[model samples]
Target: MIRSHFDEDLKQLHREIVDMGSFVETAIASAVTALKSYDVERCKEIIESDKKVDEMERKIESQCLWLIARQQPVASDLRQITTALKIITDMERIGDHASDIASLAIRITDRSFFPESEMIFEMAAAAIDMVNSAVMSYVNYDMELAKATEEKDDIVDDYFNKVKHYLADVFSTQPHRMDVAIDYLLVAKYLERIGDHAVNICEWVHFSQTGEHKSTKIF
Candidate 1:
């Protein structure tokens, strides 16, 4: 009976993490949309939604601790809970980056000042896909999917470099738009960081499944 209860608790923890992941995915998507549209109201909404993401992280963390203290989970079970603890930290930071992007979006005075590079939008899309794949890997305990998701980080990085070059060209020719150029650069940087966090989550998923921390050297 005790084992059954503990198993059920673990299942509940999984559901909560999935819910948190869903919230973060929405935050990032909305943030990028707001950036493109110069929608301050939507940006504010993403910022406000971050609080709920944080709450979800705290709740899952509490559950993990309770399982460790009360159930004395060991081996795979302990790894699973501890991996969740680590994963949520990454997930929470992903939420923060989304909020950071939205904050930047709100500060821009000229929407037309943004560069014409399509790479920024592509970078956002890649990061969002990585986050989604990482979370799904955790939910399904699929190591192969986790590995593929980690590999996708490279695409985001490539997009980041392209955006940097594009921004540099814009800055060189249009020195008066320096501030606007820098703002867009920072947005790209945030998206790059989000991709890194997604890679971290995938690493945790790999560890949870295999009990080995996947080397990020390849990343």
Candidate 2:
């Protein structure tokens, strides 16, 4: 009976994690659209919608705590609860980074042809996809899918580096644009960091199931 109860609660936690993942994905998509179209209202919308993601994170965190306290989980059960804790943390911070990107977009709206917007969007899209797969992997214990996501994360890094190297060239030739260039660079950096966090969540999920860390902090 206890095992059944724990299983049910784990399902609820996983569902909430998926919900949060959707919100994060939406935030990234909206942010990129706002950047491309120069829409301040859209930026504000992203900022306001972030509240829902925050609430979802808090609710899932509460569920995790309740499970840990009431079920007194051990072994893999304990790992699941702890994994939920870490998952929410990374998800919430990813949401925060999305908000940061939106805010920066608002500031740079009048600037001409903001640097590397497409590459940054591509990075965010890849990260969002990985975050989605990571949550699903946790729910299904799909080790194969988890392993695939680790590779996709490398693709995100490649795009990230491409933007970095391009920015280096831009700044060297057009030093007067340094301020705007730096802003765009920071947005790319934030999105790359967000991808790293998503990969971290996948590693933790894989670890929770296999008892081995999937990411060795190597990539």
Candidate 3:
């Protein structure tokens, strides 16, 4: 009876983690949309909605701790709970990055910023996909998918480098647009960090399955 109850609690934890992932995914997507449209109102909305993500983090974290303290989970189960703890930290940071991107979008009111906006959009999409896959991997215990998602970080990184070079050239030619270019650059950097957090989640997923992260045995 106790084992059955613990299993059910694990299922609930998975559902909540997926819910948190969805919240973050929406934030990233909405921030990108706000950036594309220069919709300051939408950016503000994303900023406010980030609080829900923070709340979800705390709620899920409490559940994980309760499970650990009460269930006295064995090795595999303990790993699973600990993994949840680690992944939520990454998810919360990703949520913050999304909020940061939205805040930057509001400041980037310069119409001339559109020239390189497409790259930023693509980068954000890649990061969103990574986050989705990482969360799905945790819920489904899909190690292969987690590994594949880590590989996708390269795509986001490449976009970041390309955006950096393109903006540098633009700033060199049009010194007056320096502020706008820097803001766009920072947006790209936030998207890059989001990709990094997704990769971190995937690493934890890998550890949950194999007891290894980046090929190093953690336990």
Candidate 4:
């Protein structure tokens, strides 16, 4: 009976994490959309939504701790709970990056300032894809998907480099646009970090499934 109850609790925990992932994913999308549309209201909304993401992280942390203390999960079950603990931290950081991007978007008053706009949008898309796939991998316990998600980080990195090069050219020709260019650069950096966090989530997912993170075996 206790084992059955513990199984149900784990299932509930998984569901909650998936819900959190969905929330973070939406925030990333909203942040980028607000940037492109010059919608301050939408940016503000994304910032406000970050508080909920923090609260979700705390709640999930408590749930994982309770499971560890009460169920005393062993082997794969213990790895799953531990991985949940690690994954939430990455998810929370990703949320912070989303919020940071939104905050930066609000700082740039000139809508016409972003000539590297297309590259930035592409970067955001790649990061969002990583977040989605990482969360889906955790939801289904699919190691292959987790591995693939890690590979997508390269795509985000490539876009980040492209944005930097394009912005450097802008600065060389139009020194007056430096301020706006810096803000856009920061947004690209945040998206790059978001991609990094997604890869972290994938690493934890890999750990949960194989007791290995990247190439190193933990268990």
- Ranked candidates, highest lDDT first: 4, 3, 1, 2
Report lDDT (Cα) of residue 165, candidate 3. 95
For candidate 4, give the lDDT of residue 142: 90
| lDDT of all predictions | 0.89, 0.80, 0.90, 0.92
Best by lDDT: 4
Can you give the lDDT of residue 68 in candidate 4? 87
lDDT of 2: 0.80
Runs off by more than 4 Å, candidate 1: 215-219
Model 1 lDDT per residue over 1-219, tens place: 768988999999999998888889889999999988889999999999899988999889999998999999988898889888999999999999999999999987776766464678888999999999998998898889999998899999999999999889988998998888898899999999999999998888888876788653221
Q: Write the per-residue lDDT of candidate 3 for residues 1-219, one digit (tens) a residue.
A: 767989999989989998998889889988989888889999999999989999999999999999988988988898989999999999999989889989998888785645657778888889889988988888788999999999999999999999999988988998988998999899999999999999999999999988998999987
The TM-score-based order of candidates, best leading, equals: 4, 3, 1, 2
Taking all chains together, each candidate's TM-score versus the true structure is 0.94, 0.88, 0.96, 0.97
Model 2 ranges off by over 4 Å = 1-3, 114-116, 214-219
Local error of candidate 4 at residue 42 (angstroms): 1.2
Error of 4 at 102 (Å): 0.8
Candidate 4 pairs with clashing backbones: none
Q: Give per-residue lDDT, candidate 2, residue 198.
A: 74
- How does candidate 1 score on lDDT? 0.89
Q: Count residue pairs with overlapping backbones in model 3.
A: 0
